[model samples]
Target: MSIYGYESLTGRTAVVTGAASGMGEATARRLAAHGVRVALLARRAERLDALAGKIAADGGQALAVTADVTDAASVRAAAERVRDAYGPADLVVNSAGVMLPNPVDAGRTDEWARMIDTNLGGALHVIDAFRADLLAAAAEGRPADLVNVSSIGAHVVFPNYAVYGATKAALTQLSASLRTEFGPRGVRVSNVEPGLTDTELGSHIDNAELSQALDGMFQAFGQALTADDIADLIAYTTSRPRHVNLRQLVVLPTVQA
Candidate 1:
């Protein structure tokens, strides 16, 4: 059980949601480097195809499936495509999310719904759609892994992030409960929480005041964590032995309190 043993994911198949950009892109790239056959799922077909091409160019097996996580049928179809092309998936990563900054009193119901639907509901769709395959893979003696990407907001309370935080918190709990239920069945589940990473999460914030506050917070931290930092953690966790589960890991910049 060397620390680096999981680094070689040769012959394994992985399904990665939100594989178009940011942490998802980095994670997919890293997994492919380790010889994992990766299925890229995202709303952007062009981006997914481009990424798949790059991975293939690097001598890795890759598939690009365009699907919206918010739609259960779409997710199921994507999972089926992956199974048809690469057998059962040995790994699944749910990273699709949305963040819109607004106060609870502002009556921004649409934003709230979008956040919940994409972040929490989307994760549910992916897990439920793929749970059967994951279980079957484990039954065959090849342990499966699931990594759900959460956020620091999942733990801490922050203004204008009520809906976003709630969604992430729910995802965290879901991952924990899933881990308990599946661990005995030879499936490893983990939640990776990242703090203040430089991504497009803040772009949805249209409120000037809220945007300023968030920018100030990031600046106060001096440097925000990079997407690659989170990707590295996910890669390490997924590479572990069948009996070893990393559970929950929270990563933040040193300057972030």
Candidate 2:
């Protein structure tokens, strides 16, 4: 533990999904800076490799493992590689997600399905793959954390964002349930809800109108949160003592509300 009473995160192992870009990438970098061995997981191998290389050059331990979170087999294989590289993960961050919002009357079934599968199903896959490792870490009295990156859309209503909101809401509820099941078992479960952040999450939107509206919203906020901002909170949450659990966090830009 540090002099400030915060548990030292040095020498711990962490797994961060969606680590190729945005918040996942930033969180991976932050954790590595704290001396944690990080495993970068995402569908983009090149991005993961570059990030891993950057971490290595900075004198931190990192392993790049390409994975598709929607596929159980892929996540399982990636978990095996993580175990081989850095042993069981003491921290896991489920940050892989998609936000393709469109009006419910627009009948954009494809977008809705993608959001549900990637945002909700994908998180479950990572949890299923790493549950045993987390339990093991807790059994040894290490500070183990499972952080789920949901969005403020889970609690707030937005036009043309019904499906996206549904998936996030489900994720939030799931985190709450898991907290009850895992809290006493020693692993800390945290649900993080971030509001309007400047990330590539909006670049893939198929609906032009909604995309423009999102851009306008960000512009109006003037100072929007960045990936690094959320990373800081995540690092703080995971660095607490074994007995301390920061259950839920809602982070937003000062200008956002």
lDDT of each: 0.90, 0.93
- Which segments of candidate 2 are over 4 A away from where they belong? 3-7
Model 1 misplacement above 4 A:
none
Write model 1 residue lDDT over 191-255, tens digit each, in one string: 99999998877777899998888899888888899878888898889887777899999998998
Model 1: which residue pairs collide? 6-239
lDDT of 2 by residue, 4-44 (tens): 53247889999999999999999999999989999999999
For residue 54, model 1's alpha carbon misses the true position, in angstroms, by 1.7
